[model samples]
Each structure stands twice: as structure tokens, then as C-alpha cells.
Target: MDMRNEATHIARQDGARAASAQQGSAEFLTFRLGAEEYGIDILRVQEIRSYEEPTRIANAPSFIKGVVNLRGVIVPVVDLRVKLGCEKVEYNGFTVVIVLNVRGRVVGAVVDSVSDVLELSGEHIKPAPEMNTSVDTSFITGIGSVGERMLILMDIEALMSSADMGLMDSAQVLQ
Candidate 1:
């Protein structure tokens, strides 16, 4: 092929690649856990409610703060800080519960404070590095870098649906 034709073909391929990358972009609902910031897919979030003491369940894990009734449906609330092994777990006025709907089940996650929704392109999100980390990186889908801030993108559905959480069976979640 001629040089001009080759260059035009290459430009078209680059434009297509960029468009596909943008299509993989997603929005995340960011929140604070101790000093770190984390993000989850915005589509999974049902609503955000102020922190309220939930009914304690006997034999429940420490991280499982207990369950709350949301319009008759019982939703288990998991303290994200405790689950992530944070040393400090404080519930202040800014504390809120992020209600999530995963696999037809409703659950709530306790976060220090809700930040802003971030629109991140696929290029901005990098795979989580395989290293010895304080927080469990198993639940982390990727590391999103927006400007100077780094958001730990979480796989909330996987985390909540895991057998360890006791909310749902992992096998069912996989299906």
C-alpha cells in the first residue's frame, strides 16, 4: 500500500481504539474509610442513608454491624472499616450507610463519609498491583487515579456476595 493510505488506515484504527476505550468507562460512587478513599460501581448503589444503629444478631461477625429494616426488607450492614481491618472505626455525623442491591439482595455498607461520583475512563483505571497490602486487595477491582487522588475501586458485589460475609452463597453470586 502507498504511504498515504497506510497513514490514513492507522489513524482510523487509533480513533476506533479510543472510542472503544471510552465505552468501557464507568461511574463510581466514592466514599471514605479511615484516611483512604474507595469507590464502587454507581449502578449497584440503591440509596445512601444516615448511620443508624442496627439490630444486633447473635453469632454475627464483628464486621457485620447487624441488620436494619428498610421498608420491611432486612438489610445487613457491614462496617467497611472493620471488614477492611482498619485500626480506627469511628461513627461521626458524617458517617453514612451505602445501601446496595446485589444479586437481587439488598445490603448496606458503612462508610465514614460519602464523597463524589467520579466518571473514570477505562484508561484511568489500572489493575490492582499484586503486593502485600494492609487492606484486602481481593475485593479491589482496580486502582483509579483521578488527578492527585487515588480511588481504590472495589468489587462490591463480589465482596458482599462472598461466603465469608454470610449474606449470600458465593456459588449463587457466580451464577
Candidate 2:
């Protein structure tokens, strides 16, 4: 099946699975970056689209892949793998843009492939490991442990609004 059709299938199938999340459990959209699996709150996800080359923005950061016009709204696309300092990657059919609604703004994040939504309770989440002062891991809220799999939970809002990201100005950051 084509990527777009596959995405639609996922949305429909996963929507039902997501609705079954336990009352107090948190639902996360799991995705892969390199060899690691990461997750972000499902509420922040707007939609997922097949990868398409976006228009380049001059003087933009390398990690900022470019921008794509979604319907009438132009959304900035970010390569999460690149931004997170993962090894160089080759974009293929499995590559997809995860459109996110972050802090009232729409942005696109590129991920290798989306796994599936997972619901985890508080007990399943472990506190983020402390790192040295130079290492900034504030965006990581916690680690979700499921059976033998580990998922890194991220606060995408914080990551997109961070001063260094430059996607948001001081005014937007305040909101």
C-alpha cells in the first residue's frame, strides 16, 4: 500500500486502539529515530503525512529540513533525527512527517517510522536520568517501560518552544 493510504489506515486503526486507553493512563505515539524508540503525547499530534521534499529556508538551521504548505498553512518541518544528533540517515518510503500541534503552532517532525500508540500508567514511567550540566535533556519527561521495550517520553512542546530551537520567538515562548 502507498504511504498515504497506510497513514490513513493507521489513523483509523490506531484511533480505536487509542480510545481504549485506561482512564488514568497516558497515551503516547511511539516512533523510531535511528535505533532508539521515542514517544510524545498523542494529544499533540495533529496528523501524519508521507514524506515530501519541502521548500528550503535560507539561513535556517541544518536540522530544520525546511517548510511545507499544509493546505493553506505553511508548516516548518524539522528532522528530529538530525536535531537530536542522531547518525546521518537516508529518507525512504518509511520516512514520514509527524505534524504536531505544539504550543498552538503547527510544526512537522520527521521520523523513521511510527510504531503504535501505547498507554502506560504512572507506575510504568521512570524518572529521567540526571545528566551533567552541559547536557540538556529537559525535554525528556520520563522513560516508559513496557515488557522488554523502552520508550523515551518527550515533552515536544518544550522542545519546540526552547530558545535554541528558534522556531518560536520570545513572545510565543511566553504563551
Candidate 3:
């Protein structure tokens, strides 16, 4: 190849590497579920609020805690602990509702507590391994390593769609 062509090719490769590095270093909004801390893409988070008693709807799924009136619009809330099959815990002080925008849908996810956002580099993230009958690992996007801790990156869209968590067909539809 000509020297000019070679130089151009090398420059393109360097640019590609820089872009990949930027994409890999993603900022995640962290939250806790039991003792384990989970992370989700920061861009997708809409808002966070302290847990409050929602207007209960009859025939709703067990995981769903019913709808909450946010300003004027009613939004369904899902208890993460019950959704993840974790043992029931008292929602006294640390409980929070993380409103997430996933695939053009807005839903509030109930979590134990909200943690500070953290940036995880590509080298720090590892593919989720097959845990095999312990936990449903399908909802996990990947396992992110932050120092000595591992944050389970949740697939928000998948979690919302699967199991029809009240947002799909709740009896009480807001007019």
C-alpha cells in the first residue's frame, strides 16, 4: 500500500479505538437490592423518590405495589425485592422509588436505597456467567467490577416486559 494510504488507515484505527474506549466507560446509577448493589445506565434514569403508599389496585400482580400519582399522572410501582424473589424486608427508611425510562416506557422500580453513580470501564465489565438455578441471570446485562464489589447490571427493558409487572394491564387505568 502507498505511504499516504497506510497513514490514513492507521489514523482511522486510532480514532476507532478512542471511540470504543469512550463507549466502554459508561456511567451507571447504582442502587441496592438487599445487600447487593445493582447498576443501570445513568441516561435511562428519569427520577428518584422516597417510597410512599400507592393506591392499591385489585387483581394486580403480587410483585406490583400499585399506582402512584406523580404530580397528576399515575405510574405503576414494582417492588424490586419481591420482583427479584428476595426475602421481604421492612420498607421503613431506606426504601426508594427509581423512575426509569426504558424503551420509551416510564416505570418506577422500588429499591432498597439509591447509591452514588459510578463509572465502569470496559476492562472492568465482565460477561455474566451461568449461575445455574441460583438466580435468574437472564435479566443481567453483564457483571461490572467496581473495586472489590460486583454490580449486577440489570436489563431494564427485559425486566419490565417479562412477567407483565402491572404496567402492562392494571385494572385502574388513569383517565
Candidate 4:
């Protein structure tokens, strides 16, 4: 190859390497629920708003906190702590609602507090272990470790799309 063509080819190769490095890592929005830490894909998050008392729906499940009006959009909110069977559910000043867009549907998840965005490389994430048969680990995608902190990476879309949530039926999700 000519000298000029060789230099251009080398630069393109470097650019490709940089892009691949970025693609190898994923960003997660970490949050607290009781004493445990959990994370969801940052791309799925729409916004984070302070905890607000939503208008309760009659006869709805306890975990379904209620619905909130977000700029005229009615968004159903779910308490992650309650759904995950946390020992204690408390709403304090630090509590916040994480708005998410799952499969074109808008939903809100209530968490203890909003932590920082964590960038975890593929190597840092480990597969979740198999526990008791009664426990459902389908929603748990993996466990990420960064220094002393460990984050339970959740497949929020799968959890929200489940039959129990009643937000959207599985058939509808497929469509």
C-alpha cells in the first residue's frame, strides 16, 4: 500500500478499536432499596424525580404504588422494595422515582435513593447464582462488582413485563 493509504488505514483501525472499547462496557443507573444496591440499564431510564404521593388506584396490588401525572402523562408507579420483598419500606427525603420507558410504555419505579451512574465492563459482571427453587432470579441479569460495592444488575424490562405487574401482558409485550 502507498504511504498515505497506510497512514489512513492505521487511523481507521484506531477509531474502530476505540469504538469497540466503548461497546464492551455498559452503563447502569445504581440505586438503593433498603440495604441492598441494585442497578438497571441507564438507557432505559427516562428521568429521575423526587418521591411524590401518587393517586392511588382502587383494588390495585400493594406493590403498585399508584399513578403519577408526568406533564399530563399518567404514569403508573411501582415500589421496587415492596415488589422485591424488602423487610422494610420507608419513604424518606432521599426517596425518588425512576421513570423508565419499557417497550414503548412509560412506568415509574420507586427506590430508596438514587445513586450514581456506574460504568461496568463486561468482565466486571458475573452471572447470578442459582438459589432456592422458590426464588425467582429471572429478573436478575447479573452481579456487578466495583471495589467494595456489589450491584445486583436487574433486567427491569423483564420484571416490568411479567404477568404479576399487570402493567402489560406478555402477549402485548411481544407485539
Descending-TM-score candidate ranking: 2, 4, 1, 3
User: Model 3 has how many clashing residue pairs?
Assistant: 0
lDDT of each: 0.84, 0.85, 0.76, 0.85
User: Model 1 over residues 1-175: C-alpha lDDT tens digits?
Assistant: 4554444445444534563467677899999998899999999999999999999999999999999999999999999888888878678999999999999999999999999999988778776654433334556667789999999988898789877889887667778
Clashes of 2: 0
Deviating ranges (above 4 Å) for candidate 3:
1-23, 166-175
Clashes in each model (backbone N, CA, C under 3 Å)? 0, 0, 0, 0
Which pairs clash inside model 3?
none
The TM-score between candidate 3 and the true structure equals 0.79
- lDDT string for model 3 (1-175, tens) is 4554444445444534553466668889999988898998898899999999888889887888898988777888889899888888889798999998756667889999998899887777665554435344556767788779889887676677664554544323321
Worst 10 residues of 4 by lDDT: 11-20
lDDT (tens digit, per residue) of candidate 2 on 1-175: 5554444445434433443443258899999999999999999999999999999999999999999999999999999998998998899999999999988899999999999999888667765665444546667777789999999988899888888889888988998
TM-score of each: 0.83, 0.85, 0.79, 0.85
User: All predictions: root-mean-square deviation over Cα?
Assistant: 9.9, 11.4, 10.7, 11.8
In model 2, the worst 10-residue window by lDDT is 14-23
lDDT, candidate 4, 63-157, per-residue tens: 99999999999999999999999977678899999999998999999999999999988767775654545555567777889999999988899
